[model samples]
Target: MQKSLLIALIITVIGAVAIHQFGTALPAYAAFVLGAVLVAIALTVVSNQPSSASNAKYSGPTKTLYVGNLPYRVHENEVKALFAKFGPVNSVRLVRDRKTGRRKGFGFVEMSDTGADKALDKLNDYTFQERTLKVREARTQESSGDRD
Candidate 1:
């Protein structure tokens, strides 16, 4: 993160200098456009670099668990905390309606396989927030589509 920030700062300074030096010779909009292009290029270069976190591998297989019957008010952090009791939670994605930006009463949780199994055993049909939870392995796109 620091490296990316430093690169962005350097790019911004260079762009400012270029604009200042050539502002008199070019139209006002041209200088602004040049700065915008430089910033875009710098961001693209920074984003293309592999993230260090992505290179690390977990000791156990990671499983994506389906968590359904979630209360509409339940958020990602709540789901993470509930699952964290069994094992490390890598991520929690509570699905939401794009148009309304509201929770969709379901979500996906990623954790180690062992943890996922434990969670499924304990949480399946568990009452949470006045609703019975449906915890199980998340179906792959192909399998889910075939069912439909």
Candidate 2:
């Protein structure tokens, strides 16, 4: 918080000095434009820095896998066929739009614990229908709200 305040103070001082120095010499609009540009540059510089908090890794184990980047025409049976080679699949759910009843290009697959691990290892980033698949352990929903 202190660092951000210090940076803001510094930017304000710089912008004020620039506007005061050039406001009389140049047009009034030029001073405002220069202040705007300086503020934008300052914000861009601050936002571009990477922070460690955004690098968190998933720690929980999951038996259900999320399959993404699927073709629109792909069905649940096709997904099952692709994953069946890894192990016995328990269930395959292809998300679809309720109003349109069309595939949503993503789904969830549940399998035995060992089978899920095997499938995740082998199929993650695997190419399907010319697109790389993003297969990962599905995060469980915390809410018990109506999902019908």
Candidate 3:
């Protein structure tokens, strides 16, 4: 339906017609392969058409939120409850001062659904208590940084 896709489809039709017209010059299998390749190229080009959501960086918004400026008293259950309004949460953890057992002022929470995107859109830049939340897709450590 997109202009680019339409153009690609048109080109594919033209190429198919051309191939059929000249296809007798080649062996049957070779002609078949060539036609298949052309069709594949056309589909690939069409599929590359940009989407409106292409600008949406986070693939999963609600799955994991990076909580910053968390109050020392905040618990994992409390955080889960806050996000649960959007969807079920799989897990929540406060990245803490492991030795001191003190809140690290930040943590990560994972929600169960792709609905995280919706939750993120709704809750991003929102204030919980005095701290504004920054919700985003949780990147695997390898992607964001080295885990070790």
Give the candidate number with the greatest lDDT. Answer: 1
Q: Cα lDDT for residue 19, model 3?
A: 71
- Tens digits of per-residue lDDT for model 3, 85-123: 776666788887869988877778777565566677877
Ranking by lDDT: 1, 2, 3
- Candidate 1 has an lDDT of 0.84
Better of 1 and 2 by TM-score: 1
Q: 1-148, model 2: which lDDT tens digit per residue?
A: 6787677667766776778676678655566567667776877797888854213332334388999999999878788888877766767899999999998989999776787899999999999888789998887686435365
**What pairs collide in candidate 2?**
none
lDDT (0 to 1) per candidate:
0.84, 0.78, 0.69
Give the higher-TM-score candidate: 2 or 3. Answer: 2
Off by over 4 Å in 3: 1-62, 146-148
Question: Against the true structure, what is each candidate's TM-score?
Answer: 0.60, 0.53, 0.52
The per-residue C-alpha lDDT of model 3 at residue 68 equals 68
